[model samples]
Target: MGHVTFFGVVTFVFRHSAGCTGNAISSPHRCILVPSFEIKGKNSMPKMYRTKLAAMVKNFPRYASANQPPNGEIRSYIESAGHTCELRDAGEFQSPADVVNLVSEHPKFEAALAIHLFKAGRLLMDIEIPFGVIFGGTDINEDVKVEQKRVVMEQVLLKARFAVAFTDKLKEEAELFLVSQSSKIYVQPQGIQTDVTEKFCWTEFLRSSGVRTEHVDELRVFLLVCGLRRVKDPLYLVEVFSKWHCENLLNVLVIIGPKIDPVLTAEVETVVKRTAGVFLAQERCQQELHAAMKRCFAVVNSSVSEGMSAAILEAMDLGVPVLARNIPGNAAVVQHEVTGLLYSSPQEFVRQSQRLLSDHELRERVVRNGKLYVEEHHGVKQERETYQRLVDTLH
Candidate 1:
């Protein structure tokens, strides 16, 4: 793919025999040409530009902590492109010399890709590697606001051969910091395994979470699946539900995800202890989570910030309508009043939740639309093709 800058708008020229063209018209932008291409073969994989590749991650467990939709998906795609992909835990490296030594041990690796630029825990300035930097949510969204973290991130962005973000929003946000190097930013959506089936045992979830099956039938449950971190705002629903529970409503709110932050975990624990309707459980396996979402009335996302929410997407895929924070990331997935409702305040959320619970027709409509939206937009096939295009350009 070749990119051309015309009057400040960046247009991509895709290589194909039967070329297609389109435009992205935004405010301060018009007549921006986007060329498309006809794929030549059915099994077309990107030509590998580098023979060997290394992936540097922060904490192996933390990097793989929350469901790594894009990272895991792209790793498979990269490997399929005929490059040797090796994983490195930068958490083991204490200093710049340690990073250099780790890279030195893998001399055969021609290029490296840092998954989380800042969290990789290596002084990249002193490490010599032909590497590209992939910015996670923290690097561009949170770290960039801090002067020191921004400086380090800026160096990584400036020195990297290319950069990757999970969404176009993140790509545009990346331009604010690394405006001159905008050409290197690629838009790749995370991929999910689409072979979802409703054949899982709900009893397994009950046993794993220590909640008896009797309690399941006693409450109308709403599940919020996300890591217990401050950014996720897991307690937002807890506070609202606590108030609602006093009304003698037969409803329960289950918050399930890995406890990432100890402080936030304690806060969630306190809320769970005090709140009658709220239940906190350890993160369940993916299949179990899917089954849980299938059984629930609706899914909720209360993230203060997000790139693209995999939890919300998975819920939509399972034909569950979502009630999400009225923010960019959630809005990108949930079309307000169509697929789901968005709220900025606790009052608005409670109102929406009550409405969704009471109105079966509205709930069915949203669920139908959300299912269609996910199938069309966030399907695994679409993501795989997008990655193929991105990797094709690497050569």
Candidate 2:
């Protein structure tokens, strides 16, 4: 054994000749403190393995940061499981060679995990690294509809060592693209950590947004949290609310999400201006957002598509019933009238909203069931264990 130094929890090889067998030691916590190495020759270069992670969207920090999304969640899980991992920005890499250069430089990285297959599949082929892929919404829903994206996605799926999806529906969809290795498909839902506070600061948020707390006292408010993008359909409910706005009804729709697409943001603003009682607001911090979810009568998701929506799960975790679109992703979590109500069109959405708003018993029952649904199915511990089992097989 050669002299070793601690870098972090994991071990690293240092100043060793090439072609030497290195001993990598990991603690029970999966922290690598010192790496083992064998020297081949003074001229031989050290081998390094790098894991590259990618997401198509840029504003993830606004909502997810280090706390949300299974991507960040799995990164933490893998790190705690005793692997030296690095999160590479696949968005920053301009070309295939750039990605190849980045991944090829890292030593001891035997495989890489891509959050979405489309982003990682081709890159893995270019670099010739064993890659595991996870499916996102569009990959199975919209992208597969198009011949080009579908063909590319199929190639990626065929090349992947294993593929993960957020729902069983997605796993079945993956079977269509991955004709050869259907057994490699796995279903892993996104996990959320709930926040509980006796005091909620809705008054402060309303004040900052230029709405008087006095006005809030008399009105029924509903909160919609999602990025302003085509997939999310942020303006759908705003359009529906325009017809129902009445002084006697005294209801307001507050849409709060990061402005992702400029065109979509402009369209949302147009709807907000045209629709009375519809307020378009910027994104809120997790604490504030959770508080809003707690205070609101119901949380809504008008997404045209999704892969196990985190927003729906979060709302459910907070004992808030959901009003979601009747899509595969929404149906996977919400049991129609059992946990939440689902609608097909804007008119149906209004009808469902009317029923939930007028009936207190229905609302309370759904809220109770929604919370139970999240606790049983989408807990953070359950998500972590699933990934641990998958990675344990790899080791």
Worst 10 residues of 2 by lDDT: 34-43
lDDT of each: 0.58, 0.59
Best by TM-score: 2
**Candidate number with greatest lDDT:** 2
Question: How much lDDT does candidate 1 score?
Answer: 0.58
TM-scores for candidates 1 onward, in order = 0.79, 0.82
lDDT of 1 at 136: 57
lDDT tens per residue, model 2, 219-240: 6777777877788888877766
| Candidate 2 segments whose C-alpha is farther than 4 A from its true place | 1-21, 27-59, 62-68, 106-108, 177-180, 196-200, 210-213, 247-249, 393-395
For model 2, what is the error of residue 46's alpha carbon versus the real structure, in angstroms, after optimal superposition?
Answer: 23
Number of clashing residue pairs in every model? 0, 23
Off by over 4 Å in 1: 1-50, 57-68, 121-123, 195-199, 207-215, 385-395
